[model samples]
Target chain A: MSDVFGVGVIGAGPVTQAIHLPTLARMPDRFRVTAIMDVDEPVAESVAGRVGARHSTSADDLIGDPGVDVVAVCSPHRFHAEQVEAACYAGKAAVLCEKPLALTVADAERVAQVSRETGVPVIVGAMHTFDPGWLGAKANWGDLQETVRVVNSSIVLPWNARYEDWATQILRRPPPGEPVADDALSRSVAVRDAVLGLAVHNLPHVRHFLPDVESVDWAESVDPYGYLVTIRGGGIIARLLGNMHGYWKPSWTLDAWAADQSLHVEFPPSYVQAGSSVATLTSDTQTRRFGGVEANGYEAEWLRVWELAAGIVPQGEDLQATVDDLIYAVRIADAAADLVRGEHARDRVR
Target chain B: MTEFADRPHLVTLPSGPAHRDIAAALASLPRSFRPGAGEDAIVYVTGDDDWPASVEHALSVARRAIVVIQPGYAQPSTVLRLAERAATDSVPVMIDYAFASNPAVVLAAAAWSAAVEPTGILDVTSRHAGDGTGPMAVLLDQLAALHSLVGPVRTIRQLHIDGDAHSAVVAIPVGGGVITATLLGARTELGSRGSRVRWLGPTEALELEVPHAGTAGPGYSRHVTTEGEQLAPTIYENAHRATLARLSRHLEAGAGRCDDLTTLAGHLELVPREHPSRSASQRTSDQRAN
Candidate 1:
């Protein structure tokens, strides 16, 4: 193996610092941070200085960099489809974009379509799926039979920016674009997308590990302070929750069951935990822990993506399961939108 | 609306005749903060409706923070405002759904909290679906989910779900007296999951003799059911003792000592019933009569 995998990152925000940068940094033999792109030259330069990557002012520049073997899109939700499409079009070996895949189903489909056309491996950033603890979780699924009627997932995020400052700053900079369409009041709808972004990350894990979900009836409880969802699928009644107020809470948590066995995971909330970069898994039978690179959760995900890119992991629908989860996420998001618009009774929809 | 002229610290108005006594009791609570008591207390709304701004105003004055108990009827804008205010004031705010059986509220609360500071959100939930599900099913799910999030802190000292479809009580193992937490769910006509779990501090099979509606002596033997069969009191005691035995594992692991448990539990204590205030003429007459 080469001393480094020569990776290029396209975003200079918390996610990049916490996950992408440090993950590559930890495995000097498997990956290397080669370049980064952000609209704000100074911010991009600062991140490049810390991660030892060259700075670029535009996405095109980062993609065209000769040292860049892979491109990581860590921008806002809206930019993912376009960035991933561009990376694949450039004949990059792999394309990894942050979750939700895209803000709209149309864009996500477009991105997937383009990647298929280009024959580039596109891995959606669903880090929890690659988590060793989740691997341990799968090993212990049989123990979760007795108490297994419901799965509750809690991904309580901190006050992280909805978009990297550079992205918004770029939007405001040159050729002023049309005002982005979003919810008018309290920016609740805009924030709802972020919830979907977070959900897409964990939903795949739930779907992959739990018994097959036969049908899903989900509703979004629109509290501006937070969002709550109740999903009844595969005879399991699961609740996925996100909040921005109350008290600081762990960012990712999973509680599931077997008839008499239980599994519990409590990790540090978002960036703080990401900074420390560790995953902890506890069950009735045993406890397992993993991760501690400054690279955050993204590093492990990057390795998984590298595996796929290297053809070590087979590709197909199984690889596209994240897309299925993303679609489920869309259905959930649309339902939430309906509830917020008063088109449907909140409880009736569920 | 009754004039609250005399109740200065009362945050909630007595809604109907059924709640009048509880309201009077709330009106008389000592306003001063108690030592070891958390500065925050959850003020829950028992019904579904848009929270009135007056609710926020009341919380702002009475305490440094507040959490509205809006389960099935939470509005996104309203939730956002509550969170924004809480964030601005540097005070924690929570939205509670202790009565929600629907998963929608849970999802919404989770989403709302994730959009803000992670710590700003706390979800308190049950592990099982209470769709007239059998007691064992409910207990099993509840224990599983509870252990998943915060490892089980309390041991089972008493298990009671009445076959009479009346009231039932369970004992939660605490430091001192047997904390007998009772459930009021069985008493309702709708069979709603409105269980009131109370901790009856330390005792040994200490059966309190209460006068039944007509009968006397031990109204009921505080019956214990296992797999739905009423075990003899001696047998029940043995089972209870055994269950408490498992909790020692947690005690050894330093688990059940979470500070939030006692603080959250303390709010469940029944407030003292208040005596009616006398008018000037009534006071004068009462003194003279005395």
Candidate 2:
């Protein structure tokens, strides 16, 4: 392995162009972009030109390149699992698959199996998991994981374009689609996508305290784009609320409470290169805060990939945890979708 | 405005959850109002005790007005009866909700209602210590706050309630649409204990935070629209003092209808105490079965 790991990114959309490229540009000593791939040749060439890396329209070409030691699967949701498997099978040292690793359980299992079989480390890009503040709270919160009784996750944000335009110049943008149909099936699908697309960013943290989901007590789809879901598990009740609209200021917060202790994390909105989240842990007598650091979760994740590729950390346990996180997120999404569908069916019966 | 021969005397009963705080607020009343005994005295009572009897006694004796502090769980019939008696006697009544009566809440109500779109959800969270009033009281306090900010609650459904936490879904009727409010209450001994109401609309967002009623700390409200962000002016007065000031104003005016009891009756109807005698899991299962 070279002193600086070579990164091959599979998608050059807004996330790749706005988040990853700018993040990698910050850690020049630890990582270098070796190749960029996108379905659009112009987008691939235009984005790759900025970093002086090779551009291609094929995932195979990038994954097979000898210079690409680590692969970042930033393609659309459906392509994540297959590309991750290919990257691991091609003997890459490590792979960073942008969130959801896979949409379905079977695909996620396949990615896990491939990584296990190839002995290649895979890190799903649920950046909050790698956030310095979240990590700090985990280290300092004593017995909170067991004692936590209520967990709440809330996210309210403006459209991604609002922040993406501020993050970097874009080469290609996906065109707007038709509005979602106002029907049971369409609403259920919308909610499922919401859970997997937006809430998946923090379900891993919610599942950390509420490890087992016993039931989804209630689920409702808000108008515009939002969902309210409540699930009970492991003697803890967790409520997840998300809404995306044209609001000016974005708020993303996670709060948990035990009898005498509490944890609160306020994360910066996505697509903006803001620093790490600010986390506060409060006990009966004292309060401690972590994170005023310059490094955001995107940088922290890449550093983790560099560590895994350089053999600075073991892959066995971390790989299983990644798979477990994926399973947790899938369980939540499936349950919420089913509940929403059931409610809609009942409404129609009435 | 009617001119009284002398200032109205303030009388505070020593009962209920916030008796000590109410007493302190009465002691700090402005010179226009005095604390003593008189026929036209303003009666203050919190609802945790035998409030019906206390309010009845106040109605019989006081000629000026009545102020109820943090009415806990009251039967709709009982509250309506009290409202009728207050009406017949022509004694104005005011309910002092810890968070709702904050000066900041009063200032932000107009902006909040004007800018908030009904399409999205309104999130309300209240954190309290378990050693304080129980979860029911805390929930009622939140409902009162909501009533003040968004008007009457049209419907409410209890999602879950255990030893330390309570969750409910409520719908408030806005101009032409109904906005859903998700209310969550948790009992914790840590953190800055308070109640927070937040709403994010398409082009505007409003968040209001009110500290515990015991302190005179200023409640904070922030409003953000496309144009820019604005914060409501801070006021260092707790709910008790503010409620007293409101009652003083009502007395000085002498002829306004008091709807506190009516609103409380409406809020109580939305959260009836006689929930189904089944576990939350069983209730959820039954809902799914239906």
lDDT of each: 0.46, 0.82
Please provide, for model 2 over B1-290, each residue's C-alpha lDDT reduced to its tens digit, 9 standing for 90 to 100: 53442644656454555778877887787454666667867777766535666788888998778887666665567689999999888998888876777777887787777766677788999887644346666777778788778877887744576777878888788879778898888887764788899886766778899887778899889887877788888788898888877776676677656888888888767764455312332354355559
RMSD to native, candidate 2: 4.5
Show the colliding residue pairs in model 2.
Answer: none
Tell me the spans in candidate 1 whose CA falls farther than 4 Å from its real position: A1-3, A143-147, A161-191, A209-224, A246-251, A273-296, A314-318, A343-350, B1-123, B127-290
Candidate 2 local lDDT, residue B123: 92
RMSD of 1: 20.5
Which stretches of model 2 miss by more than 4 angstroms? A171-179, A345-350, B1-5, B36-42, B53-65, B130-132, B272-290
lDDT of 1 by residue, A197-299 (tens): 5665667756644444443333333232345555545445555665442222234677554333455554444433343324444444555555444444455
Candidate 1 chain B: minimum summed lDDT over ten consecutive residues — where? B197-206
Tell me the DockQ of each model, to 2 decimals.
0.03, 0.58
* Model 2 CA lDDT for position A71: 97
